[model samples]
Target: MTKLPSVSVVILNWNGLNYLQQFLPSVFASTYPNLRIIVGDNASTDSSVEFIRANYPQIEVITNDNNYGFAGGYNKVLDQIDSDYFILLNSDVEVQPQWIQPVIDLMESDAQIATAQPKILSYKEKDKFEHAGAAGGFLDMFGYPFCRGRIFDSVESDNGQYDDVKEIFWASGAALFIKRDKWIEVGGLDADFFAHMEEIDLCWRLKNNGYKVIYCPDSVVYHVGGGTLDSENPFKTYLNFRNNLFLIQKNLSFFHASIIIFIRLWLDLVSLLKFLYDGRPKHARAINKAHTAFLKAIFKTGKKASKISTARFNGTALVNKSIVWQYFVQKKKTFNSL
Candidate 1:
């Protein structure tokens, strides 16, 4: 029998004591043979480190002095780990006993696959797909990412529509799996992103380097969406808007990036006005801050980190049509529609 490659499952935690207490046991119960479970603590003041050492003494806990957010926190913890594959799991995810095996097998079968994500279902609504990553992640022509089971805020019920394993544009960070060497080679997640869209950025770099990102629906996990940062937080808004601009600038060609960024800025202004009209001043301000930060990011980092030889987009995960127009104007809500 062939020996399984070592898999390191690292869960980044920041003041997630309740989530850890509730969900860590499900991880411990995972049936993978060659697994190393770790809780990389982001300097929680809630004695979460102490609790881990006390109750889950067998599991390794890599504690940082301060909260490095998601991107930096994973970069720090992963540097010390030596493994064939790494699963950057979120603290609030609950896994089944056989969750890791199918994904591992699929990835092992294809060395070209740099990253893969399991089918992410909602922890709250068990029958429906999660917002973070539904069946798999896909990018629109404008670099806006939506999932097979989720378009904008509309999440589809899982009726076995996306059960087939396939290539994807981006794998969700909630339960992201990547090869160790490939992750380090592509500079891992860009620390500048801080949090949101960092995974998509990483996957884009991997794809540029001639590797594929995929979805393995056979392996599934449930995510309690927005565990660290609430979805409604204006700060989340700032990160999404700012980091998406960074994503386009960093990956797409100069001509393509310029066009998309210009269009996105206009769309964002509309979103800001809608927020203000809805009496959400904080969200409006966040969008304004995002635009300012985006300008700074472009000027500060003039060069692309992951430069590719191709002149245009090569990945199958991108939807050439405008998802915004299809959803808003045409009233096509599901992924199958457009």
Candidate 2:
């Protein structure tokens, strides 16, 4: 019998007592031997720690002093876990009993595969792919992240078209599986990222370091998207726009970053106008705020990105074309269209 590597499934919770209650059972039922399940509580005021302690006594709980957001919180907790691999699972995800084995098998086959994500379908609409990460995440020429089965808001139905094992530009953080050493080598998630697009930035760094990020469709999970923050929340809007700029600036070449940032600002302006036109001033303001924060961050992040080794892989994994143009101008909604 082959001895499986030690696996730790760490769920970061932030006032998600209900979600944990609803989803923890399925996670507990995971069939992977040599598995350790842990919940890292991000200073929840709602007694989430107490609830987990009482109900799931067998599960390990690590509590942070305050809410360090997603990136920082996970970094703090993951530092203590000395496992072979760590699955940075969202509190809201519901995993199948056998989800861990297939992903582990795939990772074991390729030592260079530093990060991987399973097919993420919607918890509500089980047949449809979810928003955060569908099949696997990829980037456009301009640094927009989209999935193989999801483009912008148009999520494709799961027909197993993307079931093949292959390399991808990024893996979704919703249910990310990463080698413990590889994750530590890249310095884990960038704490500066706070939350949004942090995983993409980490994966980009992993690629720059000559590692692979892949999609393993054999393992699947259901994610209840927007559990911590809803899409309409202005703060979420601000984070998405702001973090996206930081992502590209910190990874791409200076020439590419400058040009793409300029273009993205203009596109953001159009989105702001659209928001105002739709009588949603809050959203418009959020976009405005994101730009302001991004501009302020440019100098600091620009210097840092330049210092990092930019040994990029010339691969077809990245879409050389503009996904925005493909989706809006040509009205190509599905992943197969482009």
Candidate 3:
């Protein structure tokens, strides 16, 4: 029998104690042996702490005084993780009993893989695919997120659409597994991200170092989309709108980053015009603010690229070329409507 590697599963919670109602049982059902569960709770006033204490008494729980966003909150547990592998899962997701075994099996078979994710399905319909991630997350050259079965707003229902395991550009943080030390060596997630796009940033760095990222389609799970932000909220729109630029700026080479930046700016302007047409000027303003935030972050990190010791992939800068062809030349953008 293969020796199953031990895993420390970290679920970051920001005010979603109730999500725990649906999530914890499914997590406990993980069929993989030698597993430990830890919940990292951000400063939430919603009885989250009480829920954990009352229910999962034997399970370890860590608490913060304020919402550190996803990246910040997960960083806390990352510092303390000493297991063979570390798993980062969203509070809003429900995992299958057999989820982690295949992920760990694939990683053990290939030490080159730095991260792996399960096939993610929809929490609402169960047979449908989720919004954030499905069969592994891929990035357009412009840094927009799409998956094999899930383009923009349309999730290809689990009609065996993405049944194969394959290499991908990034793994969704929604249900991600990675070796613990590699995560620390890669510096974990960049806290400056506050929340969005941090997983792709880490996965990008992982791939840059000649490490592979895989999608283990056999390990399936259900995800309730958008647990924290309202689906139609303008703030969510702004974050999705601008964080693409942040990921591209931080990861891509200067020339490629510049090209993507220009393209993203143009797209944002068009999106703003669309928002204006839809009588949602507030969303347009939010997009403007997101852009401002990216500019501010760029000015702050511009001198710090060399300090980013994790980025070892300076080869052809693959993302730029792929994104340009898919979104610009091919004009086959997915997920814009979602």
Candidate 4:
């Protein structure tokens, strides 16, 4: 009999004991033969580590000294574990027993397939796709991240439309499966990103290195969106707006990134105004804070950008047009429509 590849499903936790208690059982029930379940606790003041250690004695717990956020927390924990593959799962996700094998099989089939994600459905509304990553993640020419079953605020219900395995620009972080070597090659997730868009940045960098990101529909997971931060939180807005610029800056050429950022600023301004008009001034101010932070960190981010490979982004998943226009103006809400 052949030995199965060892896989580690590492969940980064920061004061999410409730999520851990609610979701860990489904993960423990994963039927993958060679699997290790680990909870990388980000110095949670809550009893998350204690709960895992007491209840799931077989599970491994690696506690960080301080909360390093998602990117840094995962990097710290993953560096300690040796495995053929790593699944960076969110704490709030519920998995099927067979979710692990299909993704591992897909990644193992292709040497170039660096990372992949399962079909993510909303835990609240099981019929609909989740916002973080619906089927597979894609990026517009301007660097806006969307998924097959989700575009902006609009999410689509699953109806076998995106069940086929396909290459994508980015895989959702909620249930991201990545090869161990590929994860290390890209230097893991950018810790500077802190959290939001970090997965997309990682995927973009992998694509830049001529690796393929895939979506395997055979593996599916339910994600309770906004587990760590609510969608309406201003800080979430800040991270999404700011880290998006960081993503473009680190992955694309200086000239191209500048052009895209220039256009994005105008588009963001419109969003800010819309927030103000809608009586959400906090969100409007959050965008302002994001741009300000991005500008301040330009020199630091540019240094990272300088290391990018000369290879241009030629991924099949990269849409050459603005998704904002497609969704809002053209009213192309569904991925098939777009």
Candidate 5:
């Protein structure tokens, strides 16, 4: 019998001992043949590494000297591992038993298909899609990221609405499945992003290089969203806003990026004001700080931008309309309506 390609499900952990205790068994339950489960610990002071070593003796543990955050941690750990495919999983996710093979089969069928993500549902709600990566990720004309099962803050119920296999602008970092070669070819996730939208930036680079990012509904995982950083945290807000600008800057042509970033600045100001109106001054200040950081980092990020081939935003899954206008002005709540 021909051996199936090897797959490594590398969970990047940082002070997520509870998550590991909760979800590792579910991940171990995956039925894929020729699989290896690894915990890439990012300098956790919480005895997470010790717990994994003691409890999950079969699982490989790689330790980083310092907390390199998500992007850098994965890059560091992945460098030492060899596999046909790599599933960069979050510690908080619970995988279905048969989650692995379907996606590997889908990816193996095509060389150009570089990255894919499983259908992500909320672990808390069960029936509803998760916020980070609902079904598949898509981008609007203004560079706003959304998902088939989620638009902005509105997450949809999983009624098999997005069961079809489709191309997407980005795959969620929460449970990102990537071809090992493609990952290395694109230089992995940008460490500069630190966290948030780093996967989107990587996906955009893949798209720019003439590769496909796909959503395979056959495999599913339930994500306990915001395990590392809560959604309401101002730091999460800063990363989202700042990294979004970094995403556009590094991917699009200067002319196109200029137009979109110009518009986004105004939209972000409105968001800042809304946060203040809602008595969330910290979040409002996060937006301000994010913009400030973007300005400061432009030159450094610009160097990275030059490395990528600037393709016009004509990818298959890129929506030509602004999701903000579609969701708010037209009151389109669902992905289908848009």
Candidate 6:
């Protein structure tokens, strides 16, 4: 028999036992034969660790003592990854039977491609695309995520627009594949992010190093969307807020970063005033933390660090625009118009 290419699937869990109920069965059922699944449990107090230990004997489980959050939990298995490809899948996602090989096939064909993601559909609203990622992910000059088939909050239904394989700004960390060495090369996901935007940070570094991120729509999966964290929850808000800012700090050049930061700050103020006007003080916590975290991160990353390039590309792709603000406004308009 010909030797199949080795692939390691890394699933990070943090008190996500409920998610595993739907996730593990789907993953271990993959059609690919050359596979190793590693479940990194971030010290869940729930029976998540035990459930996996008892039911999924084949899964290699790494149980940490405390919750390292997303970055820390994933970093636990970096030293243990020994495969051609490392798939960083969220515990909440359930993969289709043949998802892995199609992605692997695409990577096999392209030497320049370093990362890839599949078309993610929503499990709850079966006809809808999930919020976090859809098809392939991209970064605006301002560091906001826009996938080829998705724009901000408007995740268009799988309308065959993403059938073609092509380059992208980033791949969704939810069901993403990256070359093992490339993951190690860019230092994996930024630990500073702690949760959201880490994959964007990784892809930016990959692109900076002259590698391409791709969306392979043939690799399909259904995401429950909010599994371990509620979409409206405060910590999710904080992480999403803080991490997006941290990503800008790590990647953009000083002048470019400043423009993006100021735009975000001004929009956030508009959000706060709108919230207060609507008497929704409860929702302000996330935006408030987003506001403060950026300020602190700006101070910590240092004004001088903006001159640094985390990775080197043959070309410097810079833009003059407020990517997040424009996209969010458009997203709102799209949502309202719908």
Which residues of candidate 3, in runs, are more than 4 Å off? 308-338
Judged by lDDT relative to the true structure, which candidate is superior, 1 or 2?
Answer: 2
Give Cα distance to truth, residue 77, candidate 4, Å: 0.7
Clashing pairs in 3: 31-97, 141-323, 151-335, 152-334, 152-335, 153-335, 153-338
Can you write out model 5's per-residue Cα lDDT over 176-291, one digit (the tens) per residue? 99999999998999998999999999999999998999999999899989998998899999999999999998998788888889999999999999999999999999999999
lDDT (Cα, tens digit) per residue for candidate 6, span 53-145: 899999999877788778877887666678989898998898888999999998988888888888888877766678777766656555666
Residue 273 lDDT, candidate 5, scale 0-100? 100
After superposition on all C-alphas, the RMSD of every candidate to the true structure, in Å, is: 1.3, 1.1, 3.0, 0.9, 1.1, 3.2
lDDT of 2 by residue, 1-338 (tens): 88899999999999998999899999999999899999998999997899888998999999999999999999999999999999999999999999999999999998888999999999999999999989999899889999999999999999988889979989999999999999988899988879989999999888888889989999999999899889988889889989999998998888888899999999889999999999989999999998888888878998879876866553537889999999999999988889
Model 2 regions lying over 4 Å from their true place: 312-316
Model 3 TM-score, 2 decimals: 0.91
Point out the higher-scoring one by lDDT: 1 or 3.
1
Question: What's the lDDT for all of these models?
Answer: 0.91, 0.91, 0.79, 0.93, 0.93, 0.76
Model 4 residue 165 CA deviation (Å) reads 0.7
Q: Which residue pairs clash within candidate 6?
A: none
Single out the weakest 10-residue window by summed lDDT for candidate 3: 314-323
Candidate 1: clashing residue pairs, number: 0
Candidate closer to the true structure by lDDT (higher is better), 1 or 4: 4
Name the regions of candidate 1 deviating beyond 4 angstroms.
305-313
Model 2 scores a TM of 0.98
Question: On residues 1-338, what C-alpha lDDT tens digit does candidate 4 reach at each position?
Answer: 87999999999999999999999999999999999999999999999989999999999999899999999999999999999999999999999999999888888899989999999999999999999999999999999999999999999999999999999999988999999999989899999899999999999999999889999999889999898899889999999999999998998888999999999999999999999999999999999999999999999999999998947554779999889989888999999997
- Model 1 RMSD in Å is 1.3
